[model samples]
Target: MNRVNQVVKMHLRNKFTWFLVPWAILGANFLINAVIATSLNDGEVVNTGAIASIFIYTLITGTLTLKETFPFAIGLSIRRKDYFFGTALTVLLVNTISGLAITTLSAIEQATDGWYVRLHLFELGFLKDLPFIGIVGINIILLVNLYFIGFTISSLHRRFGSMSMYIFFTAALLIGTITSYTLTHFGLWVEIAHWLANNYMDLFWWMIPMVGVYMIISYGLLRKAAV
Candidate 1:
């Protein structure tokens, strides 16, 4: 078989890469959102709900190391560039699809929150409208950028991926969850939560560059994996 076809075939059939991890991640999101909607008051439409989706996605994308996934490319005889491009393509494709899904979801969320009247929400001077096609395009750009950043960072050094993910997640979980709990349940962390609510988007922007860094680093990692 031609090398390109082999790579395609491998990608088509790769169990670990396409099945277990991604599906499990998607399933986790589904289950959580379901529980949030059914069990919790003011669920699925709250910032906390959005945070859960965003956080899980961040952790999964951040922690996926090239070392662990390289094995899946074995016997494909593809060049490093070919492998990198192919893998990145798959990720982008998945992300674009996800963006469409999220756009539809956000519309539903808005309608629900608006008491089924589809109220226009002026969020910080931004329009509440998110056309499905527009959001799909936006998500495409987002994933491309994120993949580049993530690849660069992962490629920076071999040992940093999952370890970095673990440390950051743990610290944030400890502090953020406590803060969140206090804000929601006890009102003790109200001040901090208010401050965060005011600047959470700023915080999210801080991580975008890191994803590109990981993708650039993965370029080298892909070479090593090819060898």
Candidate 2:
């Protein structure tokens, strides 16, 4: 237990990778959006993908967390299971903090009408309509799933080298293409869209199980991983 706490504190103390860098990117995006908003004279510009940068940043951070920390943790005589659990704990804690902060900013954006400049940065259509708790839930779930996916991918690289990663991605791309082709052939786009519209929030719930799956896979790979 103490070792787990130490590991979490070690990552937390680094501050730059898991915390500052990601927020810095978000701040930069906000600044850019603010400037663009000022240039626009009449209407609102919906920056639907602006918040996405932070999530993507989290994925990179997660990958780096394991890639950079696992070796050091092992050198310090930390057990692999403890390190894995600690990393998982850090992911949850960091994502929860980020999710709450984003949710608050999103609420403010809604109330101020995008800082009175009519630039929709944090408030996207899907997110803006959700209640406060719902928004936080969605953000946390998205962050967790993305981080775990990145962590799992890094674990794969650690356990099976770069070739396996390449093959996995190629197969995923092919499978995705085939699935899309099948869906298009059946003209299920509209139905899919409708379902998404009605149950988008429910989809976030699916991330819980998805996260669990990734957690198990990452731990399994890490157990056999070379430091």
Candidate 3:
């Protein structure tokens, strides 16, 4: 492993303090899922707190570097590329583990009710087919992409180095809102909505192809940038 990767792995291994993340996530998830479960009696619907926990954790870790912590990463010889990769790997690992834990921890009324059957990491139940090997493959691939996502987020807007993150986040929200509104209003989903929704795995599979693109772009982004 490279120095950056090693540093990150160690940080992940030393996650005694990082347990705070999951605790916070658990608190948030209970609040959110309590309302959801009360309204929806379905076991899967009510037991969504596990999924909620992972989502909350990722959002927090992914945005951690938005604050300038160059001194921290630099001392560890963690390149910008490495930092995000490590962070993403950490997020994916944490989420996947957290996902399983949440699924197991969920308190359902019925004996066999659960929402932790996602075959693909991104989609809720992407890996419902493969039995054993399929689950393993999906997990491995997810870890890779999450590392890539972490890398991508880490390398961006480091030059402004200060409040650029606020700007970046604001701009991202603005762009996302406009794009979502446009796509929803436009006839973008006229035909494939059902197919896409029913076979949502297809949507997440697109990430498999996009991973390479993100890695390459992230590398160039962190090439000369100080983070």
Candidate 4:
């Protein structure tokens, strides 16, 4: 337990890891959107993809956490299991804080009528009706899912090699293409969309099991990974 905590501390030793980058990314996006909104002199500028930038940033950070920190942790005599768990915990903590902040910002954006510019940036429409806690929960779940996807990919690369990573992605693309083709062939596109519309919230629930699967796969790969 102490070792795990130590590993967690090691990741947090750099202030930029947990402190600066998230806000910087979000702030930059908000500033860009605000400027655009001002220039257009239009009505409310709704950015449906406003949150995407931070999510992508988190995904990239997840891979970097392993690529950069895993080697250092291993050199410090840290067990792989401890490092894995500690990284997972750090991701959870960081994303929870991020979720709360974003949720708060969304509420404030609504209260202020989009920072008084009528620019709907973070306070997106799909989530506008959800309660504050619900919004936070959704963000946390989505963030975790994205983080672990990157973590799992990096772990596989560490366990195997660049070639294996390429092969894995190729296989994934093949599978996705086949699935898409099957769905299209059956003409289930509209039905699928309707199903998703009916159960979009349920998608968040699936993230829990997806996160578990990612954890298992990442851990399995990490156990065999070398620095």
TM agreement with the true structure for every prediction: 0.54, 0.95, 0.60, 0.93
Clash counts per candidate, in order, are 21, 0, 6, 0
> Candidate 3's residue-wise lDDT over 1-227, tens digit each?
47656755655764643457656656575556566654565444432425444444544554454343444776767666676566555555665665444333432212234333211112334444445444544554554566557546666655445576688789999999997888888867665676776876665577688778876766676676664
**Most lDDT-accurate candidate:** 2
Runs with alpha carbons beyond 4 Å of true place in candidate 1: 15-45, 51-59, 62-65, 71-75, 114-127, 159-227
How many residue pairs of model 2 clash at the backbone? 0
**Candidate 2, after superposition: displacement of residue 164 in Å?**
1.2
lDDT of 4 by residue, 34-116 (tens): 88877777775555566787888888887878888999899999999999999999889889998988899889999988887
User: Residue 74 in model 1: shift from native, Å?
Assistant: 4.8
How much lDDT does candidate 2 score? 0.89
Question: Which residue segments of model 4 deviate by more than 4 Å?
Answer: none
Q: Looking at model 3, which ten-residue stretch has the lowest summed lDDT?
A: 114-123
* lDDT comparison, 1 vs 4, better candidate: 4
lDDT of 4 at 80: 95
- Least well predicted 10-residue stretch by lDDT in candidate 2: 41-50
Winner on lDDT between 2 and 3 is 2
lDDT of 1 by residue, 1-227 (tens): 35545555556575565446655665575556555555545333423333234324533463353455545554444566666666666666666665566556566656566323322221111225545565556555555565565545455434454576677568878999887777689665667778877875565555566556666666666565323
Candidate 4 lDDT trough over 10 residues, lowest sum: 42-51
> Scored by Cα lDDT, where does model 1 land?
0.53
Q: Candidate 2 lDDT, tens digit per residue, 83-179?
A: 9999899989999999999999988898988888877878767666668998898889999999999999999999999999899999999999999
- Give the alpha-carbon lDDT of every model: 0.53, 0.89, 0.55, 0.87
